[model samples]
Target: MPRDTPPAERGQRLAVYSHSDKRVVLHVRTNAITHLPPAASKDFLLLCPHQGVGEDDPAGSCPRGNTCQYVHADLRGAHRTTPHTKRGAVAGFYQTHLPGSRWLVHLPVDGECPPKLAILPSRCVLVTRATPADAQGSLPTACPHFTLRHRCDRGVRCRYVHAVASPPESGIQPGRCLTGGWQNDPYRAVPVLQSPEFDLTEHLPFA
Candidate 1:
């Protein structure tokens, strides 16, 4: 896993990936991610929905609308997708309102990939922000991108999960096919991160 903020520094650009005609950056109103640990290892991709995103250029105009270029995939049970074959595969990502918070994940051994992120279920952990939850029901309307402590089965603390790009409502969306597969794919056998910076996480879904 990447160090929380260093993940940002690893990024050489500000945009994670541009979908549709319009490009999507960190949104304060429409979209957001949250609840990152001080470790800063969990990387998250800020992806826009399957809408026409504007692709406006920097200090100028975009020839095409900022929309995503990746193909619409029908997520199945335990099925995973990747941006390698897609045009808008996110090569990097940026952290909002934080210094040295722009980092680009290394491309998958196969094609390209955004940085890896480890965010909890629905809780958003902020630097100085905290929101309260309700009783006997769903979480707050304003969902935090990431939470640290996610409770689960067998007296086990499943708190160290990463925030993947797949949709949350669906399962297997959290796991991605990256680096390499167990065959001709070169990255299959290798771990995503080469350095020792990321050792706290659990078995990779890809692994």
Candidate 2:
């Protein structure tokens, strides 16, 4: 099994949000996201901005990063057509950062996995849910949450790789909205904006 790797060795960009407060509790890694791997803990819930956890918990609230509480929120295993569950702490403990891009990846390996890709001036691109098309044409459209923002560590322009289906379906669609979960159900994130959408936003205007 994978033991706890050192912070530097792991090289991941993980974010933790407190469910009850909706605040980014602890953020790991950095602006460089190119490795993002899943955490080996029970906390750390994966998230997709487009596939919001219902309007009540649009921000996800880090279902897995409850720190002391560790509330499960009792979410359904599959994408159920129900209202917001119990608001679990959205988890983002990572093994690496994918860099650039915006929009969370759901770790699927069946279809195109049209992630929300971002092209930064620094020439870095990955996936995340921070960029918005209305801001600059970088993001395809507002994420399902519609709260996250575009952020880059180097003051750059980011675009959304995908996002079409108005109200995301959790299932695969075409054009705008992108579906993940092609290989593993692991969720990954790349810093996109300097806003609170990302964990760093809690610190300040991200680069």
Candidate 3:
């Protein structure tokens, strides 16, 4: 049924952020998040800092311009000038960059869903495993079969280690993995078989 749904329709659903009562509701299928009700005294909505800074102005313009990633007041047609007070500016900056801020959350564009949010194949393990150490005097090289084919016919009975070495971090932030599903099942003791086509690190958010 998910595959049958039109991409445009899915995207439209993801863009809808509704709030009821005080708790937030997360639409896993659409990646839409309903935020908690804002406090009466504080408005959480943040305006973009580069709203009116002209390209040629010495103050410097919004680097992204029309394509700026932030929520700009001018782009939203609010027509409000940037705050001059230090307190107002600081509050706005924190609200805009807060880890859990709603403004930072965005719907996937052009059907390019985050890998962790996307429905990955249930037959694979999403977590990368650390490689096993070599025996006392044995060579540190990995098993040829496991390195070349990701698996060996001998299974646990193999003389050499069959684990895949975790790759070095690329310093790129990975997609967030929501709890639940077979890929995240805690009761399952055995790790799923790794597939050469899918790199485990690429799918894990904390990897």
Candidate 4:
């Protein structure tokens, strides 16, 4: 099991096969993986609903004007008229604000399952997990691009990385000027000692 995998997704290796076209009979959303092969399990590709916008960039634009590129699949067929028309596959999403973009998770294992059109449980929606800063459980680092407005919009949905934000720097404290200056002197009568020895009148050029 990968260190970053969520507890919900951490299941025993129930089966393993080399066939690329084979579909593993299980619904990740329903926790109904009883049909998995009884053989020693190896890494397998779980079909994710978050197929990002296809090559048609404009086709994936959300109707709510939010910048969601991933399609919200209608796994239950809640809004499909024809089998060809994907239920959740609407032209554009009505949400004006989806917190973040969906991540494209490609497992590094060999013989990973390719995308397939199979019905599965709805609860199996894939959510991203926090990246490990190190194996020692050190604090996770945030996505550098996340600070930019474009990246911040993705919030947790980003597949890259996230972290607990540090508190903003406190406003500069009001302090005395180092150069010894005053914006306003309230003491109208500042005492001054007159130097009798140094006469400015005698040193004057006109004198």
Which candidate number maximizes lDDT?
2
Per-candidate clashes come to 46, 52, 0, 5
lDDT of each: 0.23, 0.27, 0.25, 0.23
The runs of at least 3 residues in candidate 2 whose Cα sits more than 4 Å from the true structure, single-residue gaps closed, are 1-15, 18-21, 28-207
lDDT tens digits, residue span 1-207, model 3: 012222234332321111221111111221221121233222233223443321113113546644543322222111112111212222222111112211111111111122211112212111122122235522222233443343333333334322222233342232333344223432222211221222343442222
- lDDT string for model 1 (81-198, tens) is 2211111212322111233322222212112322232322221121112122326422221111121122111111111122223323222111244444323442222233332122
Off by over 4 Å in 4: 1-129, 132-134, 150-159, 163-166, 169-207
lDDT of 1: 0.23
Worst 10 residues of 1 by lDDT: 77-86
Model 3 local distance difference test score: 0.25
Greater lDDT among 1 and 2 belongs to 2
Better of 1 and 2 by TM-score: 2
**What range of 10 consecutive residues in model 3 has the weakest lDDT sum?**
101-110
Candidate 4: tens digits of C-alpha lDDT, residues 30-141: 2222233223223432222222211113223334322332222212211101110111112111111233332211111111111111111112111224443346633222
